[model samples]
Target: MSEFQTKVSPDSETFARNRKDMLALVERMRALEARAAAKSEERRPVFDKRGQLSPRERVSALLDPGLPFLELYNMASYLVDDPDPDTSIPGASIILGIGYVEGVRAMVFADDAGINAGAMTQKSVDKALGAIAIAERQKLPFIHLVESAGADLMRYTVELWAHGGGMFAGLARLSAAGIPVITVLHGASTAGGAYQPGLSDYVIGVRGNGMAMLAGAALVQAATGEAAQDADLGGAEMHAATTGLVEYLAANDAHGIEIAREVVSGLGWKACGPALPVCAEPLLPPDQIAGVVPVDYRTPCDMREVAARIADGSDLREFKPDFGPATLCLQARIMGQPVGLIGNNGPLDPDGAAKATHFLQAMDQAGTPVVFLNNTTGYMVGTASERAGMIKHGAKMIQAVTNLRVPKITLYTGASFGAGNYGMCGYAFGADFLFTWPNAMTGVMGGAQAALTMEQVARRTAERKGVEADEARLAAQRAKITAHFDRQSDAFYTSGRVLDMGMIDPRDTRAVLGFCLHTCQEARARQLNPNSFGVARI
Candidate 1:
């Protein structure tokens, strides 16, 4: 009886427009992901000559067949790598995501070695480190397909070199924490990259192709005048036989992948909890999500309409629905996971913030995970709102979100501007996982509002000086401010900067939520085997 009544109107022109814009954005997101794959594919010939499989092919081979591979940060370093829309190859020269490996879900990080020799950039390094953090926190095994040319010296910054050390540190930490860290060296992993396989619990190196050593023959000859072939110095066979570095040495790339899968399979890892309730798909079709949200978030639509398609059986039990009507707190089961979802039908007033604060604590106490659907234009501003203890109650909601021990997952379905972003568990608050729809935008405020505020300040300055505001100059300035905000607030651009995990297609929201929710809960239930140190070379 408490289930939300769907009020979606698919037949309306607004729905048609929303559907069209949303689909275009989703297509754009996919096209960019394809671009990264294409860039890697172009290097197939080079990899073929070396008798090595491409980065993505290695991932495909490593993961179990036909299961979901939830790719993370596909648009990573998108425009940041190369600003041009035609040429920016994102994903930091890596194909990284979470997928099932030999029936065990693991975090897979593969150097898209075909691109820039799978060179590590600032973004790429950060991405890998982020995945490792997830693995250690979520209890997922970490698998790395190593074949990196190391850091790009041409673009080197001291900060990047220093930050890149975290990748090796993360692997070491994973091993020490008893979360398996597996490295399959498909090709060269020299210099700083050598430690990647070295720190892992299990290292599988390919006999002819794989190489892992602190120094290569060129570097060794340059420093110490010791000239030797690559294999004799640091080849997989050498490491396996002489140094005790590699646990398994395979004949080639495919064989190396097989070894990695077998290593995971041998872990005998399983989910520690009882089976979840059966998931009956929502009554409202998922594709309808495209039509539910207007791309220009200023256009208002019921958040419940979107919720209907995401919650199972299209049921969302509204909590305190009468008070703080603009803020929605709903109890729902997403793929059998009990969740408290908070969404904004409008800006958060004092009442709304207070209500959300109470709801967050309830969910926390109940041990239920929370999902923040970011869409507010921040807490309400102006004289009336200020008098209502806006800041006090807003801070309480944020505190509750920050202190929550239960898993926090955030999704930016539309506009999330100002303090609303923070109050609703934005990135800085450390939501366990954060994702966005292609249409989502978040910032201090919307472009129009920002530009208008500046214009008002300019006009006020002129009025005080007893001079008329220059209409043309004022108009030009407003346009400039709006354009700057619009460009930076774009989902693709933000996702490129690693602002969110990735830009997801709106239709896949439900499935992605289920997977993430399950992952978080499983991690909480599973026990870890702690040790004194990471697997050492000695």
Candidate 2:
């Protein structure tokens, strides 16, 4: 302790001065970065769309407060002859980084349409690939805002294998990693850009700004002589209504960003539980939820209100509110348990199979218990339906539900007919339990439709047998067929192969649901942690 004790501590003034100097150095570096940013801005082209927010700006609005964006490939770009000297603007067309959305860590990448029409350069591809690799390695959600003019033809001329793009390879690798990938289309997303989002788990589009496909109008016209407008070529309506490429159709850019936030929050993040409350509310008045009787099968009812009532506290975060309007899927808490609810839109247009498949797949991965609220007249029909590839699209839902491992509870709020029953997670469709309220008039088809069919059958039989078919008897037969699987009996759990091995106790809906949630919670052992990380996107 001789020499050490002899050494005196530095004076407070000297220490303070050194600390100030270090801070000053940091400020100086920040000023230099700002100056570089300003110089880059000076070189940006004054294009037709100046008011539109940049990708970085959009990301700023979308992410959580106080979180920093670790920009990937910040200095990677064209070496020379680039008209736009704003290096920060394009960042090689793809901006990949890790950031926090709502305090949840996630990987975010965006195709900057403002730069080279968001073309995919080799540098950009590498940046994207690297970002996704990081995301997968870290088990973070990957968000992509794609809006590109496809790959840079300039980068491809030298190599014939350029056609065998490495971009697809990167996407395949990212998909195989099983990281929840979410995409938002804010502008034209065609060819390679379109393919990037195509492989993601969740894809959303803005009504006017979003688009996706192998070819746009100009290319289609050049190749097939098909002149088309933007909407006809690749718009939100085109994808949502026909191709089913977009899972959600946003009302506008703001709507799109909000939807993106929701999607990110709902991603399969095991670090934090859902924010929705699970306490079940008191049963709604009988008048509010009209009983699902035989007559109710043909009648269209607003399933949304029904969903709100069923979800505890009536707070449900409905996904894809606009697109795939026919099928209503929501994330909510029932009796304090995370529940994924899928319902049938009584009158809204079925957005087609692509959306159905997407919804089912998303729900399956969410790892939340599922609730099916059936109310549909089966799949859409006619040329419009065929054009949207309904058969192929809807089949995706069937396959997903079959493959899903979560406990599914079906509540026949109204009609459950034909494929609609299956789509709504019918008893045979792997639902753990199917329950109907006292008003439920369960059947293979609507009694009215059955009545009409019986009328036709009666006429056919009368003509052949030369005898008057008993209309009353025929009516009874129609009722029997309507209630074939589930007779219009009370809500008792029956046995011996009738309607879901017999219906669960109807009056016990509240109790049954609460018990099921408790059982599920116990099975999982997910206790509330005071040190909960809360909802995070990454």
Candidate 3:
């Protein structure tokens, strides 16, 4: 293995500018995350008055102490509810992530009942489905902190109603796969929401607060002219004693979470496999990554520099280095876990595409996981490049990525444009896990190019119709299109919309990669006892 040498000049003007821009982007992300937290905090008084813990508080208390919790899609529905961005809080009235419960790594999600009475939204439903997909794929145990008023009818749509069934289907799938599904009802879980806990293998409900019913007392009386109390309808005590819906009844939120932890502890999950090879930290300081990647996506930087900063001991064995320099393929170890890495120094030419395809296949043959450090304007275009078979080669690369059996992880270090996104295993390619840098941008192409293309189309249409082209109108239209695309392509916008999980600081790249790699490895090694149907309550 050849040691990668760093050529980045930290004191250079360009590096300083890059560092400043990257830090500012990171700051913006932090502020947005803080805003979401603050919004949830605003309901603290209400939760306290009800003798319950906040959604975040419940999550914290449920997880093991000193364990790393990777929260996914923390900003799911930002700016979706209204026009004003400030008024829209992102989290989709839910909190979801992977964390340790009783030493067992599991997928845990909680209803943010503190927000909008834990009403379900389109994005929240998507986020929940995404979380469930991860848990199902990784064979991780599923845990839910159920507290929801169900779907909000005011803003509900037929699409949301139709897609809502997937949530229940996912729960059943997880249980059928022999992965335990645990639920703790901390508050209301009415109507369709009742199935969330009902489908779980184990359920714990808070005595005074927990409720799960198809219809509340008011609805029962309104429909049948029979007055009934909530306690008789779906209260925790009723479910635990008579309905056989809840397995355990707790006095409060803390007790419910405690019981959940205990249930996970009793699962008898196997321990993780043997550790990877011992390796030293990267010789290059990971902190330098902030300066290494320019904020401007157009500015070129060596992807190898990023490889060096993340690889253990800065050792990366280049594979066919001279054949295709732009698309770098290398073998390196992150935290002693060997991995094949594909990165970009420029657009994917025919040669680069072929090289990457070969590299992906070789890695799969070797049973090594691959990590994509994405940064490209996509495949090289134009008459010369197209003549060189760019489309054929790019398709081959995409095919290799799509068919690979190995776990694929993607990190958008910079611009991920055009089919380069697919070739590099973007979200559509079903990466085992995907994350982006605070400065990353993902779209079909840059905003400027898209605007110009639309402008040309409009001008050509006017000419074909024998009408004089309106130059001023075309210019104004182009400006609007450009601005919209630019805003939509921003990292904040993409991340908020759950484009690729969530954004991370450049400095934390190695640690995050190492954590995810280990997770994938453990999942691949573990075995499960599947049944024809999921375990059900009597």
Candidate 4:
């Protein structure tokens, strides 16, 4: 394998300009993430008065000291909650991430009760389910710091109740699949929320604070005219002694977290993977990635240049290069771990699609993780491409990606448009950990193309109606359409809507991918012990 030569010059004016633009986007992303934490901080007095730790504090206390925590969807429900993207509260009232606890890796979900009393929102449900999927795929333990206000009745939607059941169902499935699920009730877990800890392998209820009940006092009185205190109905003490639901009762929030940590430690869990070879630092610096990748995605740049900075020793063994010049399949090592990488040079034609399909199958056969550096206008469209079996070849690539036996990680680094998004492991395609760069754009098509397409359609319709096409009106319409597409395609906007995990600076790509691939490899190597059902009360 030959070392890739650097094409970008940090001293060049273009590189400087791109780096400046990229840093601005990174700053904007940081501010949005900070805003979520700041919003929760505003309710610190409420949490302090109640003698409770915030959701974040619980997660920190549960995880091992000073370990990296990969937070997911920090901007969830940002614009969805309010029209203003800047001032909106994200995280959907829940904190979700993967972190090491008691020296064992696990997924943690904590309800941000400091925000809206931790009411379960639509995106909040989606975020929790997403975390569960990652845990199941990665074969990691699941830990939940529970404190939710059930569902938001005022902002009611039928879909919220419908989709929210998946979280509890996921907990049951994880336990049945031999994955540990530890849930700690730090405060209220009312109505349907009770099933959360009920399905877990281990349940810890914090005394004087934790509450899990099928019906609260008001609900019980309204339904059957029975008068009973909520504490008597389903407090930690009641459940611990009467129902046998609380496996461990804690003195407080901090105590509950300590108990959860002990349970994880007692599981006798450890991760094992193939011994990695000594890794070499790439000749390129990670800081140079901002300069190497064009801030303006429309400006053509070789994705191989970006790969060079991340690949160990800047060496990528190119596979079937001449066959599909536009679609690249490169075998390389990142942070001492081997990976089969797919990067797009342009729109995917039949040959490119076929080549990518073959590459994916080969990687899966070898049990190597696949990383898609998506930067495509999409699958090629036209009579020439159609005649070459574009649809059939492209379908093969999609099928291969969909059925990949190996871990699939996607980075929306650049332009990811149309069916190309689907073919390259888009959000819906189950990429174990899909992410994006701040400069990335994803949609059915680019803004200019989409606007031109609609304008053409309008002009044709006008001509068919025996009316002269109004140029001024069409121009205005095209501009409007372009703005609409551009707004939605932005990485920040789509990320806030819970598109990818969240945006990252281009410079951090190597570190992020290395961490994710390491986790995936651990899952593949570790074995689980299963039973007929999850650990249940006997």
Estimated TM-score per prediction?
Answer: 0.98, 0.43, 0.97, 0.96
Q: How far is candidate 3 from the true structure (C-alpha RMSD, Å)?
A: 1.6
The digit string of per-residue lDDT tens for model 3 on 1-538 reads: 9888788988998889899999998887778778778878999999999999999999999999998888788667876765466676877888888889998889999998878888998887888889889999888999999888899898899988888999999999999999999999999899999989889999999999899999999999999998999888999999999989999989999999999999999998855756666889999999999999998889999999999999999999999999878999999999889999999999999999999999999999999999999999999999988999999999999999999999999999999998999999998999989998978888989888899999889889998999999989988998998888888877777877788887788889998899888889889988999998899776
Q: Name the candidate, 1 or 2, with the larger TM-score value.
A: 1
**TM-score of the candidate numbered 4?**
0.96
- Which one wins on TM-score? 1
In terms of lDDT, the best-performing candidate is 3
Q: What does candidate 1 score on TM?
A: 0.98
User: How do the residues 166-261 of candidate 1 rate in per-residue lDDT, one tens digit apiece?
Assistant: 987888889899899888989999889887887888999898899988888888999999988999988999989999989898999999998888
- Please say which candidate is ahead in TM-score: 1 or 4: 1
- Model 3 off-target regions past 4 Å? 458-470
Of the candidates numbered 2 and 3, which has the greater lDDT value? 3
Question: lDDT for every model?
Answer: 0.88, 0.59, 0.90, 0.88
Candidate 2, which segments miss by more than 4 Å at Cα?
A: 1-52, 78-90, 155-164, 268-538
Instruction: Give the clashing pairs for model 3.
Output: none
Clashes of each: 0, 8, 0, 0
